[model samples]
Target: MHMISALLFGAPDAHGSRRRADLVQDLLWAHSDPEDAVQHIRVRPHPVGLEAVLLLGGRADGAATAVVALLGRSAAPLSRQGYTALPPGAPVQPPVPSGPGD
Candidate 1:
């Protein structure tokens, strides 16, 4: 029997780096990628919701792959050709206006 550590989970930093990292968790709480070395990380808001896209480099010099979070705590790996770098959704639509007259 295997038990996953709870400390490994969290609201990941949508914008951060984990270069040559030993531990990289996908948006989906799937298996922890302790084998591969994480080269890059990109988090963007999609139509479904916000997610993290992990760019991984193989440990023993394998080809790179893009990993995304699915429905739950699980990850789906994709090829570079299949992955799309969509523009991040805007956080705020219209900025609140403040006048000199308090």
Candidate 2:
């Protein structure tokens, strides 16, 4: 499984509560594949903040890639808040590439 996080910006549109709900639904649909089985999807809203955390099992890379695509499509400015693996650790350093002198 993999987890993806994103921060949604901008104010609610007409219809108030319904607008926010529709936006959230659209975001989820945009980020998820109908065929794929999603393990968990969570949406949290604050007075001035909207956060979404998606837990996807199976081939999670697809879901992660979809999120990047959806963020690009969204009219509202969405920023990638942060990300972490299951162990909740920093990234590993790749082996240094050998120069001309080996």
- Could you estimate the TM-score for every candidate? 0.27, 0.45
TM-score of 1: 0.27
Off by over 4 Å in 2: 12-23, 35-37, 46-48, 72-102
Q: How many clashes does each candidate structure show, in the order listed?
A: 5, 0
For candidate 1, list the clashing residue pairs, or say none. 28-73, 28-74, 29-73, 29-74, 30-73
Model 2 TM-score relative to the real fold: 0.45
The C-alpha lDDT values of all candidates are 0.32, 0.50
Q: Which ranges of candidate 1 are over 4 A from the true structure?
A: 1-31, 59-102
- Put down candidate 2 lDDT per residue, 1-79, tens digits, no spaces: 8887655543434345444545575566665555445566666653334555666666765766655555455434232
Provide the lowest-lDDT 10-residue window in model 1: 1-10
